[model samples]
Target: MDRVCDGIAVITEGKKGSWVCDGMTVRKVVINPVKAVDTTGAGDAYGSGFVAGLIKRPGDIDYALRLASINSASVVQQIGAKHGLILRALPQGKKWMHIKVEKY
Candidate 1:
């Protein structure tokens, strides 16, 4: 938070999960595991999903982060960046609801 400019900072820890900092508080959200065939485009999926979630439901930080996790996990499960073609088309409905986000 000290070094980041006036904006939210998202730090992902691969399979472990991710930490989000907003210059004040830091929130950690764990991700569900998936068999990664290819890690290509996982980061891109996460960023796009997070932004899409925010656009769909502004001010819902948890929703955005969860969506990001879901997106990345989905990408890694498939082979190559082609999985991105189905981005939001993932069939895991309400998947994020089952994921527990540790309250800080």
Candidate 2:
């Protein structure tokens, strides 16, 4: 599908990684392997993470894609989209590469 506007992210299921393309460049991101219980909310999780990354790191597309991957990974591990959502803070001992979004 030609849904990609500025850039595109391909979600690879049961694979080692996912990828993002910005027309001029393509970046493959490695995701930590996990057993997915349900995929009902993976897309939303990715979108949320990407947007969060964009908001936190205005011009870093790579960061956005990584955030999206992380979010999607967390979502699929749970049964529902919202259930596994990481509303605040990353996983255990995980540090945000970009500026962490602070609630005002």
Candidate 3:
């Protein structure tokens, strides 16, 4: 985890999830299901949100976690890694992308 502090590592746990730490402070932890889609590039989306939050408001751990969580959730709802995902900014764009989830 300390390696994450050096900006050299990011942890990804299959059953547990991913964790990023800075020196002694834990940056982010993301948990995903064991059975899911390909999950390719999912980490990119997560990292992007995390970095964006960090840049927008540095040291705001809670806000960064929330943003990363929302993005991660969105990524898992698709059939492929990057399908059925939408990114929009309010005011400029108020459109909606309806995604149906089937529960068994």
On lDDT, the candidate that comes out on top is 1
lDDT score, candidate 3, position 20: 53
TM-score of each: 0.85, 0.72, 0.56
Tens-digit lDDT track of model 1 for 1-104: 64866777888888898888767667898887878889888888888888887898997778888888888887888888756444545445776666556656
Residue 4 alpha-carbon offset, candidate 3, angstroms: 7.2
What lDDT score goes with residue 24 in model 3? Answer: 49
Candidate 3 has a TM-score of 0.56
Candidate 1 residue pairs that clash: none
- The 10-residue segment of model 2 with minimum total lDDT is 95-104
Q: Per-residue lDDT tens digits of candidate 3, residues 1-104?
A: 55325652446443355555545455445443434555665666667766676777797654554455445556666666676343543112311112111111
lDDT of 2 by residue, 1-104 (tens): 23556555455443356656656666666666678999888887888888898899997877887777778877888887688887877767554344232211
lDDT score, candidate 1, position 83: 66
lDDT of 3 at 34: 32
Q: What is the C-alpha RMSD of each candidate to the true structure, in Å?
A: 2.0, 6.9, 8.3
TM-score ranking from best candidate downward: 1, 2, 3
* The 10-residue segment with the lowest total lDDT in model 3: 95-104
- Give residue 33's error in model 1 in angstroms: 1.1
Rank ordering of all candidates by lDDT, starting from the highest = 1, 2, 3
